[model samples]
Target chain A: MRDIIVVAGKELREIVGAGGGRKGLVRELLFIGIFGLLFPLTQVEAWLSGGVPAAFALMVPLFLVGPHVADSFAGERERGTLETLLATRLPDRSIYFGKILAVCGYAWAVTLLIILASLLALNFGADVSGRGGSPTAGSGESEFFVYPAFVWVAWGVGSIASGLLLASIGTFVSLRSKTVRGAHQAMMIPLFVVILGGSFGIPALFRSLPPSTQERFTELLESMPAVSVVLWAVGGLFVIDLVLLGLGARLFRRDRLISD
Target chain B: MTLAVHTEGLSRRFDGVTALDGLNLAVPTGSIFGFLGPNGAGKTTTIRLLLGLLEPSSGNAVVLGRDVRRESQAIREQVGVLLDSDGLYERLTARQNLDFFARVARLSKGERDARIRALLEEIDLWDRRDDPVADFSRGMKQKLALARAFLHRPSLLFLDEPTAGLDTPAAVGLRSELVSLAREEGVTVFLTTHNLLEAERVCDRVAVIRQGKLLAEGPPEAIRGGGKRKLEVTATGIRPALVARLMNTPEVIGADVDSEGRLILALADGAETAPLIRLMVETGVEVSEARIAEASLEETFLALVDEDLNGRSRVESASGEHPR
Candidate 1:
């Protein structure tokens, strides 16, 4: 157990000190800048019905989770540090968890910065628009934007769990690949599939319903409990992540140290 | 007796081709045992198996009295390994690399700093301790590797082709350090190399392996003495009569004239050198020189490998003649 902590600490220090930490921060800043422009240009108020905060909340998962997940193991294997990591006396599970934790830490930091920037942008825009005085189309109605409390808690929990699941999957793929390009190429397939399913397939499935059926489906989605649904999805992903981590540990052969 | 490393019928095969075949090796504690073999002779495979990096197909290995497979973590904590390539993080400075490994090896903060300082000094890299390892030369990298291997002061060390690419001075320095480590610190070293001369210089005992089998194993002198012995005699004004007189000696098994007109004798008894010298001088043959031609370890190794190859072929040919 002591060895595990020592190894994990060393890995964490390497991730932070070896320029990955700085690069991740830079990436986070770039994400903020891009989203900062796109939010107002797309007139997020129209899309969200004066609920710009909810649109920003959805963007948080997309911007922070993908790069953090990809960089966790694929980046280490590219830098030849993976072999050095496996050489330590730490158990495989410890290394796996340590890497996951490091990725989650980076993702959380980035997400926090994004949330803060989004909130600042929204307030600054509102201030410039004369204290919400201009009566837009949906201005009189109460907007159901993601509240600050909900955004903080939900992003924190969802990013951590999602980052871990993706990191573990990335690690397992990295262990099986010899080159960084190969691992990254293999890892992107699943990400692409997820994006395709979320963007096109889900909306198409909803569109296939009749107008009456669609109204009923919308009512059902609105009535569903958010916490329970999020819990089920996050719990299922966490279980899958643990299994993949175990598989990664089993495949972490010491001989690959020399072969790499 | 406590053995630093012991293997019984250790075998490893890849895709039905055996890399190491039923190898049994025992390295005594505190002995610098040299594992000598040619290229593709399973030296690396044996080292990997002993270190638990490669799983043996048939047998087991015990390192420092712990099962290599079952207790690899325990064994690894007590053993230092230096493979052919220096496995290091190139982006990190020399001090950082050592300190990182030292911490993982569980050295305290103070111990880690002190050892890193001492090892940098020992390797003559104190001034460059803060420089990234990527800027270091091959020799300097090798020195750092040696330092890393001894960071935790492991009792047993496995070095695979440690000095293969080193210059003369660097090789000599590392060899001296290794010898001193075994003699002074009582650290048992398992070294594998193709350089017979280097092995002859530093190793107390060597095992010559070929085709995944042990051909000959002993001290250099014992192996050199085991092969056929030759005697050379130089004489001025030696006639046929002088040659006949030398041949009449019971110890002279056969005699031949060389291209230089000097007589060479094959001795049946190596212990009769004194009598032969006396006989040559007393016969008025003006004996200028008399010395036994000592066989070298290389010669012994070649002879053994050649013999084994010939034996295998003969067996194959004979088996072909059988009905089955």
Candidate 2:
């Protein structure tokens, strides 16, 4: 456990300090600068309302996690630090989990911070100084912006589940990739497929189904409670995470790592 | 003997091609043992096997008194390694690289700080501790790497071509420090290098390998086999007739006057030297000095490798097999 923390800590430091340190962290810093502070301030009223804006709490973190995930295994090999780290007394599991945990922890923490900053922007913006909308959006009474209780739970669970899933997939890609660029390129393939398939292929396939079947599917989705659908989605993602993580552990072998 | 590293029939094969053949070795505790070989001789493979980075195909090894297969983590905890790569994090500062590894070694706050400082100063990199490793020269990085390997004060260290990129002075300094570490601290050093002179100077015992097999293993002098030695005789009057006289004798397989007018005689296996000296004196060659020229580690290494190659060829021809 202690070794895990130590490895995780070093990994975080390296991630935070890569490229040229602060100058190299332009992307990450820009992320917090925009989403956390500026975006909320610019769209105060809509951000305060819970819907698509609230969904950013989940989507933003996963977006932020993608590139960093590639750095977990493939980056170390590219940077020539993998062999030395493997030579250490650190147990294999610790090193594996440590890197995955670091990626998740950094992305998750940033997500939470973005949420906190957004709240601060909405509640304390110049337009909302008197708890009423000012020049930022339409002039109207606006109470302190706060997420509903369910909003917090929903996005929090959603972000974590999606983050782990993406990171697990990234782990497998990174282990096989010789370069970070290669890993990222490989990761993009499935991501595009999933997004495109969900966006067009599945719907197209559904349209190809019999009209009666389409009606039946619509009826079933509509009959299911919103909370139950969310729970089912989260549960399915969790199972995929487990399977990918199990395969990742199998892939993380000392000899294979060295040979690769 | 109390062995720090022992291997029995240890071997590794890749896709039916053997990288390390069946081998046996016993490295004594608290000694600087040099593993010498040309490129592709499986020196790095042996180190990897002992460190449990790679599993052996048909045998086993014990390092630091733990079975390499079952107790690799234990062995890793007590041994330090500097492989083909320096293994330094290039983006991090020199201090940060050492500190991170020191932390991984689980040193206390106080120990980590003190050790990092001492090592930086020892390597003369304390002034540049804040500089990233990528900014340092190859020699400086190599020196820092050596310090990092010693930070935890490991009982056994496996250094593969540790000084390959260092300057002469830095290499000398590191060699002295290596001797000091092994002598005063009782640290066992398993070093592999192509530098036969360096091996001869610091290594208590050395082993030579070729084609993934052990060609010779012993003290430097021992491996420079005693049979068929060379003798150099310097005299006031040396001529072709004298060389002919020496060559005619059964003990002298070959004889010639060298650039300095010394008769260089290649003696037959375990041949007596007294008869040659008597013959030289009787020939009235006015012999001034006569001494058996000892073979250096490099010469011995080459001779052993040549013998192994020729022997392998002969065996292959006899067995009607194609030479690899």
Candidate 3:
């Protein structure tokens, strides 16, 4: 556990901390500002109800994790550090798990922070618009504005699960890729497939369903609470995350990692 | 003396190409043993195998009293390695890189701090410890990598071409440090290099390898003195007849005139040079100078590698296949 954390700590510093330099920090801040402030401010109702905001949120990890996770193994190899890492006394599992955990943890933190900031921004905008009926206001009582407990919890868990899933996939790609650019290129297709398929393909398929079938599906969705669906999705993504991590571990051969 | 490493018939093959073949060696504890080989002569492969980063194709060996095939991790824990690559994290500061490896080595926080400081100071990099490694020069990076390898103070060290890229001063400095490290710390070092002079000066024992085969293994003097000593006499009155007579004599293995018209005699083992000089003088040759010198390691190494190449070429031509 200590070894894993030590490795993760170094990795986090490299990807997000002072080691990332001014350009990296500025790029990350820009990304956060655009997604967490601009997008949410432009679509206050949809951000609260969850449609375009949710899709944008999911897309955030894909873009952020793509560069960070690709650098996990492939970057080390390119920089001639992987062999030394392998030669260390740290267990193979520590190095593998440490990199995955670090990348996922960073992506997860950024995603959650964006979501919270967007929520706060939306609420502040509402209050400024005089929609939040404050008791001090001459008009009556200002309604307290908050996303339901279920929505916050569901989004938190689901966002983390989604980050882990994508990061794990990126880990596998990075482990096999000879260069960081190669890993990034390899991840693009699968990432786009997941983003486009989950957003447009699956929903379009549901729309194409027979009216009776669509009604039954709506009934099923209605029968299940939103929290339950969120939990189910998070749980499913977590399982896939585990499988991808396992596959990554299995493929992390020291010889193969260093050899061409 | 206790053996630090022992290998018998340890070999490795990559696809159809043999990288190491029938390597048998025993390195004494606390000795600086040099593994001399050319670029493609499998020095790195041998180190990887001994470190258990590689499995042998047909044979096995023991390192630090444990089987390399089964107890590689145990061996690794007790050994330090510096390969051809300087494995330093570029983005991390020098202190951070050492800290990370020290953590992996499971050093206590107190010990880690002390060791990192001491090593950095010793290598003269303490002032720049906080600087990113990417900002370092190649020699500086190499020095840091060397420091990292011994940061844990392992009982055995494997250094592959440790001084390959450094300028003369840096190489000499590092070499002296290595000598002191071995002597003071009692660490057995297995260093590989093609620098014959460096091996002669720094290594207690040396092994010459070519084409994945062991050519010779012994102390520097012994390897240099392996064959007959040659005596060169700078005389103005040498005769062709005397040269022929010297070549036929049992004491003289061969005789020839060098490009400078000096008498070069390949004397048999334990042959006296005084008698040869007297005989030359009696034969009306003015012996201005007579010098007997042992063959240098460079000469021996070149001769062995050339012989191996010639033998390979012969076999390849007969089989109609070029050797890799």
- Candidate 2 falls in which docking quality class? medium
Off by over 4 Å in 3: A17-20, A124-145, A204-211, A258-260, B167-169, B235-246, B251-264, B278-286, B312-324
Top candidate (DockQ): 2
Q: Write the per-residue lDDT of candidate 3 for residues A46-123, one digit (tens) a residue.
A: 666655555555566777777788888899888888877877777678888898778778877887778777767876
lDDT per residue for candidate 2 within B95-193, as digits (tens), equals 999998998899999999999999999889999999889899988988888898898999999998888999999899889888998899999999999
How do all models score by TM-score?
A: 0.77, 0.86, 0.89
Q: After superposition, how far is residue A253 of candidate 1 from its true place, in Å?
A: 4.7
Q: Which sequence of candidate numbers ranks them by DockQ, best first?
A: 2, 3, 1
- lDDT of all predictions: 0.69, 0.80, 0.80
**True contacts preserved, each candidate?**
0.29, 0.69, 0.54
lDDT of 1 by residue, A70-106 (tens): 5555665666555445544656666666666666666
Model 1 C-alpha lDDT per residue in residues B1-324, reported as the tens digit of each score: 578987778888887888887777777788888887778888988887776776788888889999978987787788887876677777567988898789778899999999999999987999999887878998888888878889999999888888876789889999998999999998999998878788888987777777777666666666666556778878886678866876888888778988987788877844577887777678766887877887577776677667777874111111122111
Clashing pairs in 1: none
Better of 2 and 3 by DockQ: 2
All models, RMSD in angstroms: 7.1, 5.3, 5.1
lDDT of 3 by residue, B167-248 (tens): 8988999899889878998899999988889999998988777777887777887677664689988988777888887787
Quote the lDDT for B152 in model 3. 95
Ten contiguous residues minimizing lDDT sum, candidate 1 chain B: B315-324
How high is the lDDT of residue A57 in model 3? 51
Give the CAPRI rating of model 1.
acceptable
